[model samples]
Target: MANAKLNVLVAEVPEVIPLVQEAWRAHFALTFCTSLAEAETLLNKRFDVIVCGTHFAESKMFDLLRMAKSKPKSQAVPFLCIRVLDGELDGTAFQGISIATCALGAAGFVDLNRWRREYGFDQAREKLRQLVVSLAHQPT
Candidate 1:
């Protein structure tokens, strides 16, 4: 375990907080934020991963990624976007955003209901564990 405690900043709804926390607990030192400002504050420090939901008000996925790209500390950080809905994700949604120029590291679009049924908290934790291990081993 390179660092068992991975700093994770999540920007999602109040209801989703517990679920995300439960899901990622094994792999992350979870931090839940209802607002983008709070998320941004955490971003200013160190983070191994970021899990963002679709409903974040002030900043969306692209906005956060762009900010991450600009920051020297977070340039290689892995970003995961959690889409609650069951539709195709439009890459164009982030068009014209500065982060659009950079390839998004890794993302998993999961239907909230489906995730609960099939890949619940335990499964999510396993997935995150694998992801962290892989990222940690990658050459900079």
Candidate 2:
């Protein structure tokens, strides 16, 4: 059989969908959702990565991170948070989740202008590609 594509669920504001989709296209089967419940449903369907926007309204980003981390099936899956500020990434976000990468932005938005102008999408795609490759080769 052919190799399976890595599954990724992106939980972010609707405005960031284009940028997130562009950045993740080549590496994984990316799906975007605007709500935590929707994201959870996607997870139930199976995903290797979960990328969340730090600006989610109902819960702090860390809370969603924790939810993903607590699931045994998703514990080894990577969880990434896109943020608008710089600070220490809380270890709690990775309490059970495997890898977490925080991509910085200027304000609350994803900064798509910089993404296009600076090849930020390319950079994200490369990083996500590496992560998927590593996961694929990991011992089961």
TM-scores for all candidates: the values are: 0.65, 0.60
For each candidate, C-alpha RMSD in Å?
4.8, 7.5
lDDT per residue as tens, model 1, 1-140: 65567677776778778866676677668878777567677777777666666666544766766666667787677666665544434445533222443355444443343444567756755665576556544665
For model 1, name the residue pairs that clash: none
Error of 2 at 13 (Å): 0.8
lDDT of each: 0.61, 0.57
- lDDT of candidate model 2 versus the reference: 0.57
State the lDDT of candidate 2 residue by residue for 1-140, as single tens digits.
35667777777777767866766676578878877777666666677666676665443566666666667777666665554333423446433222333322111223233343456656745654565456545654
User: How far in Å is the alpha carbon of 136 misplaced in model 1?
Assistant: 4.9
